[model samples]
Target: MGLYDIIFYLFAIITIASAVVVVNSKNIVHAAFSMLLTFFGVSGIYVLLGADFLAVVQIMVYVGGILILLLFGVMLTNKIVSVDIRSGSIQVIPAIIALGAFAAILFSIMTSTNWKSESFEIPTTTSVELGNLLMSQYVLIFELLAILLLVAMIGAASIARRDKE
Candidate 1:
């Protein structure tokens, strides 16, 4: 295999392993940390896929922002560590059925989609292009995302504070 394949496989393995632990781990903190590893591994794989921008975005948004928020949730919600972090007698069968149905739909969509392959000459400057595109075409989307994050932070803080009273 090539360097890309090696790196991709390594990252994929880390991502899957961490993701499994993220869902199954007994400690909430460990689960949060495993999610962090999963996000980092996925971001690394994105970089290997020749999407530097997407990789940076995955790290920044998922790892830096979302994972931190998740960690905060885990920390703030639980005052003391419980013996069994995971709930017992969970409805796994229904979840599996739902996921299987969703997966089938996704597979069908993937098979049906006529994806276009674009060939592009490498531009000397991409950062400027991307910035310009975001500003000119998607500034509203950026503003909306900022507002969403602000709202989430405020809501989480309010909920956390409510426990005090």
Candidate 2:
């Protein structure tokens, strides 16, 4: 096959594998690491789709920033590391039936939907376009988001710190 096809399949396999690991892994830290890999694989897929800005942002925010914070939170907050948490039942019949029905619905939707590509897409620098939109059309939203992140960071820091009293 072609080079792109090979790369796509490799990334797709890693993505699915990491996702399964993220859900199935017993070790909390290892599960977090697997989740980061899954996020990175998805970003690689975005890059393969020619959405470079989205890919970069996904890697930076989801993998680099959010995942680190989540990992740290797990390590700092939890007293115990590996525990056998009873999540679900051993009955596989219901789960298999649900998965089969969902798959059928998704397959039918995919077969019926004919996706169309735009002939002339306006190509603009994503950062510049985002900045322009943030300043003009969505200034308040941008400011609010910045404030929210700041608040979250401060709150997390406070929670993680040892109490002086």
Candidate 3:
């Protein structure tokens, strides 16, 4: 009925369709690309929900970093092009049953809940406040996380180097 609702539905449809493609595609490469579209659709939904930080993180971390890494790993692997990567649907009946159960649960919840509409201002930018909090309140934790990632990177590089020797 509204433009926002239309856009939300559009993104939701795109996400669901792309997720199905990712699951059902025989080719690993195609599945990975479909996963990229799924990530983009999720990011679009985040934007619509006024979670700008999460939207950016979804694009940057998932689409940019993880998807690219997955694509590179798939491309660089030997003999992947010749591989049949078709996943058999061994649990189709069980999966459908579970899906139906989950849908019923969601429908019941939606129908039972008394929904209220409230008007509130959503922040235009959360990054500045988040940055200040990280710098001031959570600085130690942030620094520790940085150190942990650095250590992991160094360990991975060392292992790769040793493998080459």
lDDT rank order? 3, 2, 1
Task: Estimate the overall C-alpha local distance difference test score of candidate 3.
Answer: 0.88
- Can you rank all candidates by TM-score, best first? 3, 1, 2
Q: Compared with the true structure, what per-residue lDDT tens digits does model 1 show for residues 124-164?
A: 44567788988999999989999998998899778757464
Q: Which residue runs of candidate 1 sit more than 4 Å off their true CA positions?
A: 81-86, 108-114, 118-125, 151-160, 163-165
- Residues 25-137 of candidate 3 have per-residue lDDT tens digits of 87788899999999999999989988899899999999888899888877766367667654455777898899999999999999999999796788898788788999999
Candidate 2 error regions (>4 Å): 80-93, 119-125, 154-165
- The alpha-carbon lDDT assigned to residue 10 of candidate 2 equals 90
Candidate 2 lDDT for residue 101? 100
* Full-model lDDT for every candidate: 0.81, 0.82, 0.88
Q: Which 10-residue window in model 1 sums to the lowest lDDT?
A: 80-89
After TM-score superposition, the amount by which residue 118's alpha carbon in candidate 2 deviates from its true location, in angstroms, is 3.4
